[model samples]
Structure formats: structure tokens, C-alpha cells
Target: MNFLWSLFMRKPALRQFALLDAQGRCQAFKECNQPPVGNGWVEIDEIRLSWMHRPLPARARVSPRPAQSSRHQPLAA
Candidate 1:
């Protein structure tokens, strides 16, 4: 019957790929260059496991400020 068919014919969900670590943790695609402990496809909803694992942009290093002069005395108001 049409009703039975509707119940069984649900739309297929989207598939997502993920890399897992040795402890079964999810890793981001950018970090896939490193050796994997475990790897496989994951559901879209499970993407959160790897969300925080994404590689961050490299930050520029800042040099320390020069030492202040010792003779700089503050004037009284």
C-alpha cells in the first residue's frame, strides 16, 4: 500500500567523512596529513566531534617592548 511504502521510503541522509584518533576522537580534514589511528565516514550530525579539531592559522610572533628609561620621573599635579 501507499502508506506502507511511505513509511519505508525515507530520504537518504548526507554522508560526511572524518578521521579518528587512536582514542576514537574525531580529527579535521586539515589535520589528516598526520598518521591516523582510525579513519572512516561519519554522519553529518557527528561533525561536531571534529569541529574543534580544525587547524588554526599561524599567528605572527611579537617582539618584547624595549626597557623604559630610568630617568623618566612623573611630575606632581
Candidate 2:
């Protein structure tokens, strides 16, 4: 069905995996480069994920301030 296909492809609805850390708390993720902790998929009681990645610092907007003013003349020997 087209509805089913859409759900499967939808990144928000599709959970790549969940992992339990040593602290016993479970973390939900959209994806992971490494294998999940349990090595299997299981029904989760709760899930949380941020759909958007934290925006990276844009080079265009960020301009570093000049460390020192050029008005000071250098010492002569």
C-alpha cells in the first residue's frame, strides 16, 4: 500500500535503533555508525529523537575579532 510505503520511508516514524548504556538508561537514535548494544530490535516503551541536527557553526556568519588593534607601534631597537 502507498500508506505503508510512506511510513516505512518516513525518517521520523522509522527508528533505526535503541541502545541501553551501562547506566541502564535507554537512548533512542535515528542511526548509529556502530552496532546497537542489544544487537537486536525490540519494542520500546518510550522513544525520543531530534529530527534536526544541531546547526553547525556557519563560516559565513562567524567572523573572528582581530586579537589586537594595529594603532600600537612596535618598539624600536
Best by TM-score: 1
Report the poorest 10 consecutive residues by lDDT, candidate 1.
Answer: 55-64
lDDT of 2 at 76: 95
Judge candidate 1 at residue 38 and give its lDDT: 51
Query: RMSD of candidate 2 to the true fold?
Result: 20.0
Please tell me which predicted candidate would have the highest lDDT against the true structure: 1
lDDT of 1 by residue, 1-77 (tens): 99999898976544344554555444554222222355442323234442545532222112333666789767875
| Predictions: Cα RMSD each | 21.0, 20.0
Candidate 2 lDDT over 38-62, as tens digits, reads 5423333233453123222222122
lDDT of 2: 0.40
Candidate 1 Cα errors over 4 Å, as ranges: 1-14, 29-38, 44-46, 49-77
